[model samples]
Target: MIVRPALCTIVLTLVTVAVHAKTPVATGTGGAVATISEQASQSALAILDRGGNAIDAAVAAAATLGVTDPFSCGIGGGGFMVVYLAKEKRVITIDHRETAPASFTPSSFTANGKELDFDTTVASGLSVGVPGTVRGWHEALQRYGTMSFAQVLAPAIRVAGDGFTVNDNFTRMVTENTAKFSRFPATAALYLEDGKAIPAGTLLRNPDMAKAYRALATGGVRAFYEGPLAQAIVDAVNRPATKAGSAVMGGAMTLADLANYEARLRPAVRTTYRGYELYGMPLPGSGGVAVGEALNILEGFELGKLPRAQAEHLYLEASRLAFADRNAYLADPEYVEAPVAGLLSKDYAAKRRALIDGRKAPTASVAAGDPYAFQRDASVPLRPLPAKGKLLREGAHTTHLTVADKEGNIVAYTFTIESWGGSGIVVPGYGFLLNNELTDFDFTGPHPNVPEAGKRPRSSMAPTIALRDGKPAFTVGSPGGATIITTVLQTIVNHVDFGMPMDDAIAAPRLSQRNGATTDVEPGFAGTAQAHALARYGHRWSSAPEEIGAANAIVFNPDGTVTAVSERRRHGIGSALVQNKAH
Candidate 1:
């Protein structure tokens, strides 16, 4: 909440604007919004048009997303928000990441000394964490927003009551999770048509969610964390509303957990990338540290001057090196002695960079680098790295949105319910899915990310804001589980180093290397000459998901105008809108 003295007060503001088409790019002067869903983007634009600040639009859009993109994010889940305050000329972060309940322990995911099946765990109440999205929204509004909670939440309440047209992406996700959703009667009733997937173009409405929003708007944050809603959440988690004959693992979440849940205000992780200052969410999100470390490693090379394939090769290697450290050390800073300062150190990056061979990739797993020696604080002890790093299976489903108001206030937010249809158990009357976020923790450890009482699990949701010469240049973020780091890092590289336009940077194919033996690449990238060239460098490749990340960004142009960009192909092609067209 510290505000530095303002250096630049002139910021692009928003005016009444209209979006004619659901396009992937929008350029204007006043304000801009980009998100995976057209409904969410429009909600944000509407807020900005009404003279709301970026924080207001962001919350409005997030609430709308809960209605339109229910499987991805909602009040049932939690997320990270990175915000740039125009008046203060400062970047701040909100960590509303879900926390393990007091009942959780290191062995919570185990049964009879062995780890439980991952998929089985994901579908059970045991996977649900105390949701933080509601409180996070409250914190944002209280601290920064100029609009009231009732005002920002109005659009989402309308969307919930009026309904929205389900698109192909929505249908596909439902179809993929049919079995999981069928286990719970409430979930089945909402998303399925007599135990079958709901078809595309279907108009879906959740009056219960609308009612829930109305309760929040009337009673404020207290209604959610103290009264009937809190009791319902605890009941759902502890007693699980499942059909008879279905065996579901119930959680131990209590009303106290809900009452005590708080969204923390954390410092934004800052790093310099090619002269631009990048600010992103810090722990308990691993994205900021991991992306910053990778970019720092890549900074030693003149990536723009190198062959495209060569530069990509370096990018992949840097990602691998960065992930190794991230997996070994990064976690909830309150619980783990994370070497954050060392991890972001240029010296540490240079040391890790030396491992990259220009001609070829490493033949074996790249081990985690020792960052303790580079730690600025001499009192911190060195932590031992595990002999074998276990790759926790995090869901590759989430949503991201970027918003900017006329006053130059910008917000980049990434939120999730942990998995598509999350835990597959909706609170019988609440009309939202609880997060399967506990599954994000390591099943067994000796690891920093092992489940613990009241600890937030490490997340890959990276919401970033970039500043150039003391003013905002852009804000960017993406949703793709662990690949989130690579998506964000590569997108920044594409725009800043490769000289791609913001739209092109988001549209370009992606590659993700998480210290694995093989790098996962999108089909578009695999079919290119650069892929072939990289193969010559001993880089092994595998097919990535249909898409790597659904990214959204807003770039501030030099002429006081702004450009909003979204994916043109991935996730049904996101929507980008501007408040007013530049003349």
Candidate 2:
């Protein structure tokens, strides 16, 4: 077995408070925020309290996450944001996924006539991609926000300077990445104390990160992509700050790559499920297409009328089918011709759904289904299927935040740096980790997701906003690599088909089956009656139990109030707060 570095390790710190207790659910009338950290949720709630719209509050919370939950996400990474515009009566999306540098090639991860070991590339600068988080945030604020970059970034800046109390999560992440972090002087200086992980409850200050935020506040996006900050980033990637004799591989990133970076406003992926319109991120992120396909497959069944176990069996089967197509066809649209319209077509879903046996799981592995016949543009020929590519490993990390304002505007955003400490190389003086996102590409070629110059790697971030009868229904998202699709899909199913409250839906146990031979079931679901009933249907579970995803959601009630729900068990419980609620 290949033993890899702990890529999913993440730290969760509390802002100003010495002790923290996460409130996983909150309900109020005006506005609400839910995230993995208390400080981030509070930061967003404060913005809403100050009369800022959901877009403004989302930016504030995301920025604050950089300070309190550094290992999960920050300005060093990129993400996708789905926003609901109450006045415009439309949903829009921002695609800020990191792109490979101009120097990259299809064979970039290859070495000595073969693909390099996955772990070897993980912590090296060779895995770094051009970051887009800052640009994405700037675009969101400039186009849809009521506040300036400085205004939204104030909370993060203050938290970074004031210092936060480290918790067990913080110490655990440091301990897991000690070997990698120790190799870099800059990374070690902050996370490690004399080559050891800092103990829990210790007050950790990051003046350097505060300085970084201040620079962006004054210099704008240009400061991050062109000025001294850009230079520092390029230097860090090209010549990583490694200790002598460590022999870490540096990247080929250049100033031109950084300067050329820009976040885009892409059309959201739209589909209807049970009369509700679902909107999600477009290409370069597979969440929407995959989730939509699975939902389409499930729509044929009356899950509400079926036995709970039977409904769950179908859900798992649908996930397996959707993932087969996702892995086979989805990639950066600029590099590949993915038949997205066909993939999400109801006709195609009916055809795929026919393969599921209600009484049993597929005894053999499922193959990708053909969707070209349902393509809107029938003239486009089907591309020849290549041999299956190596599964690009993704750590179950990253972060998701949801916010809604009194205006009815809502934002569901998910962002990441791709691993615990990213490439585990901290930029000298910048106090942020560069993303190892390029590793998301399939290492070998002759495939859709192969590495190429300026190509954006496909992501599983499904930030979703659903609407019923032209009004907001709910907005949901999660952070868990490939399982993100299943998590979001299941949560929606739990609430819509099974008639659970939003909080109960999120708190429910999860099962992730991504075309694998055995489904990965959470411990909470492993020994239950549902598991046994499913087992009779030939459904096998992974030997080891795994928590699937940390998902957050907001439910819009018929009464016009919003209920924000966070994970009650995952990521040490999450924080959910509302603008008018005193709790």
Number of the top-ranking candidate, with lDDT as the measure: 1
Q: Mark the regions of model 2 whose C-alpha exceeds 4 Å error after superposition.
A: 1-18, 386-390
Model 1 misplaced regions, further than 4 Å: 1-21, 543-545
Between which residue pairs do clashes occur in model 1?
12-406, 13-30, 13-406, 14-406
Expressed as tens digits, the lDDT of each residue in 1-583 for candidate 1 is: 1111122111111222332357889998888999988888889989999989999999999999998888889999999999999989999999999999999999999999999999999999899999999999999999999888899999999988877777778889999999898888878777877677777766677777887899899999998999999998999888887778889999999889999998999999999989899999999999999999999999999999999989999999999999988888988999988889999999999999998998889866788888888898977976666436546689989999999999999999999998887788787677888889999998888888999999999999999999999999988999999989999999999999999998999888788889888888876676678788889998887755456889999999998999999999898888999999765
Which residue pairs of candidate 2 clash?
none
Q: Residue 162 in model 1: shift from native, Å?
A: 0.6
